[model samples]
Target: MSANDTAAANTGSDERADFLQALGQHRHFLRFATRDLTDEQAGQRTTASELCLGGLVKHVTSVERGWAGFMAEGPSAMPDFTAMTEADFAKRVDEFKMLPGETLAGVLDAYEKVAAATDELVASLPDLGAAHPLPKAPWFDGDAKWSARRVLMHIIAETAQHAGHADIIRESLDGAKTMG
Candidate 1:
C-alpha cells in the first residue's frame, strides 16, 4: 500500500531471511558431520563427553521444537526446569545418546522436520518482539523475559554449538573432519 508499509514488509522479510540462512548453514555443518556414517558409528562415543553425532542432531531438534513452542505459547509451553525430577534428568541425558534401535537416518529426518517447522514459524510469527517470561530455571534470571527473536537466536546458537560438537565427535570416531 504505502511506501512505509512496503519498507516495513521488506525489513521483516529480510530479517527472516537472515535468520533462516544462519540456521541453514549450521544445520548443514551438523548434518555434514554425519555423512556416510553407520548407525553404530553415529552412536559411538569417541570423546569423554557422552555426545554422539545422531544424538546431537536429536537434541538440537528437541531444543528447536521446545523454543519454537515457547515463542508461540509462552511459558506454559515449557517444562518446569527448576522442578525437574531424576527421571526428567535421565530423559534429558538420553537426548545426548543414541539409544538402541535409533538410526542415524531417523534422527536426521526428525531434525529436518523440526528445522522446517522452526523456519516456518520464523517467517509467520506476527511479532518477533513479542515477549514471554522464561520458565523458572536456575540458569535464568527470575524476572527475565525473551522475545521470539531472542529465542530464535538461542536456537541458532544451540545448533551451531552442537554442530561443532558433532564435528569433533566425527573426527574422533573416524579421523574425518567436517571442516579444517
Candidate 2:
C-alpha cells in the first residue's frame, strides 16, 4: 500500500496496543487481589459493602462483556436500565456476591475468558470511532453517544475502580495487599 495507508495502519495498531495494555494492567491488579483465596473466603464480605473478591471479578467480567457487546451491536446489546424492576435490581445486586456453589476459580476463569474476548475485540475492530447511543439510564444524558474507544476506556476505568475495591476487600480478609 501507499505510505499514508501504512501510517494509518500503524496508528491503528498502536491505538489497539494502548487500549489492550491499559486493560491488561487493571485486569492483572484485579486478579492479583484474589491470590490464594478459598471459595468461602472469596465469597465473604470483608467490608460494609456487599462486594467480595469473586463477586468483583464476576461483576467486572459482566461489565466488560456488556460493553463489548454494545461496541459491536449498539444500544440494543444492553438492557434498558430505566426500565429495570425490583427483581432485576436484586439480580444485579447478586453480581456483587459469590453465590452458593460459585468458586473463585470459576469466577476467575470466566473473567479471563471475558478479558480475552475484549482484547480480541479491541484488536479486530475496524474503527474505534464507531459510535452508538447509550442504553436508556438515568445516569446518562438523553442524547449521549459513546464510541467504541470510549466504551473501551469505560471498561478500563471500571476494571481499575473495582480492582482497587478488590484490593481493599482482600486486605481486609487476610491483610494481603495487591499494591502498596
On lDDT, the leading prediction is 2
TM-score of 2: 0.93
lDDT of 1 by residue, 1-180 (tens): 899879978777578788889999999999999999999999999999988898998899899999999999998999999999999999999998899999999999999998889888888999999999999899999999999999989989998999999889999999999977
Clashes of each: 0, 0
RMSD of 2: 3.0
RMSD per candidate (Å) reads 3.0, 3.0
Residue 37 C-alpha lDDT in model 2: 92
Q: Over the full model, what C-alpha lDDT does candidate 2 score relative to the true structure?
A: 0.93
lDDT of each: 0.92, 0.93
lDDT of 2 by residue, 63-94 (tens): 99999999999999999999999999999899
Q: Please report how far candidate 2 places residue 60 from its true position, in Å.
A: 0.4
Q: How does residue 55 of candidate 1 score in lDDT?
A: 90
